[model samples]
Target chain A: MQLKNIFQEGAIAAHFIAESIAKHATKTEIGGHNIFLGQVRADDIDGKKVTAIEYTSHVDMALEKMHEIREAIFAKYPLTCMHVHHSLGVIKAGEICLFVFTSSKHRKAAIDACAECVERIKAELPIWGKEIFEGDGYQWKVNN
Target chain B: MSIEIIFFGQLADKTGCSNVVVDNPGSIDALSMVMKMQYPNLATAKFVIAVNNKIVFDNEPIEENAKLAFMPPFSGG
Candidate 1:
């Protein structure tokens, strides 16, 4: 399954996506839920203050990559369910930008699956965001 | 000619726009056109183009209507 646009107003919280995912997985007898949320910070870059961010993506590619991540995680981890969400366009500092949630019969499997899914997204996804500094400069961050 | 071009990160900053179409037929290659008009400084920069989100380099054929996304090296967490 895929989520089209995940948000609650200006918020990018993972809980919304997790709730939706839970609703979609009624047959899943999960006992643990592991969630990771990525937030934007006012990072300082070479005297520039990053106040916000501008995001862009190859939408079709990003979706495809996300699907691949889900499939890969399922193959490696015995998870009951998984969900991934990302923010496009501009996300202000203190705003949630990305979320990955995994549920399983055991905590270890949930945690492991969550980690792997997020890692794959960072490595293969074609989404990009530019951190808007306080000054006239910006920086791009990926999961390094 | 129909060409799909995508932008990302700093290159998007330089381009002041996201993806765009060329529209008219041209002899210049897609990458060359992007390099020439979009981010000329990238002429020597390390980067890659994702044809339908798969990264490939050197003589990657540009189909009539394939979605192409361009990116520079990335650093994140």
Candidate 2:
């Protein structure tokens, strides 16, 4: 099966999350679902508060890497389904930038798979974010 | 051989453009040498090379018209 494109243009909305959960109601085999949402934090950098993050990516490479991560996760865990979404454009502070959802027959698999997916995506994908400060200056965000 | 080099993130900003076609320096390390000379900022920038969408290590030979990307450390969620 082909992998889905995880990039979205704007912040992921709460309604979208609810819709995603509703779509899986028919899958009776799934007993538990775990989610990980990455929200943009308003960080004070050098006394300048960050207002938003403008995200960019090497789309072709990111998709290829994400596909590999998905395959590896599926091979390691007994998951019913998995979905990953990330914002590509500007996302304001306190906005949701990433959404990872995993479902499984048991809670452990779902929770573990969701956490693993978030970690792998953060490490492996070719996505970058420029932290936009309140005064219009920007800096490249580095993951800690 | 001529190859297309795509830069992302801060590398693109430093280079002032996102993509360019450059004379293939034959090997990945050779390409790095040429790029460092062309874009001085790259000399100290930490990045990885991907040839045809797969990350490659040192000494990987570049094929004719291959797509190569210089990518900085990822900061995705």
Best by DockQ: 2
lDDT of 1 at A9: 28
Report the lDDT tens digits of candidate 1 across residue range A7-108.
222447556765666684575577888888888888776777788877666667667666777778899999887766777777888888778778889899
Q: Where in model 2 is the C-alpha error above 4 Å? A: none
Count of residue pairs whose backbone atoms collide, per candidate: 8, 0
Supply the TM-score of chain A against the true chain A for every candidate structure.
Answer: 0.82, 0.97
Q: What value does DockQ give for candidate 2?
A: 0.93
Q: Which TM-score value belongs to model 1?
A: 0.78
Worst 10 residues of 2 chain A by lDDT: A1-10
TM-score of each: 0.78, 0.97
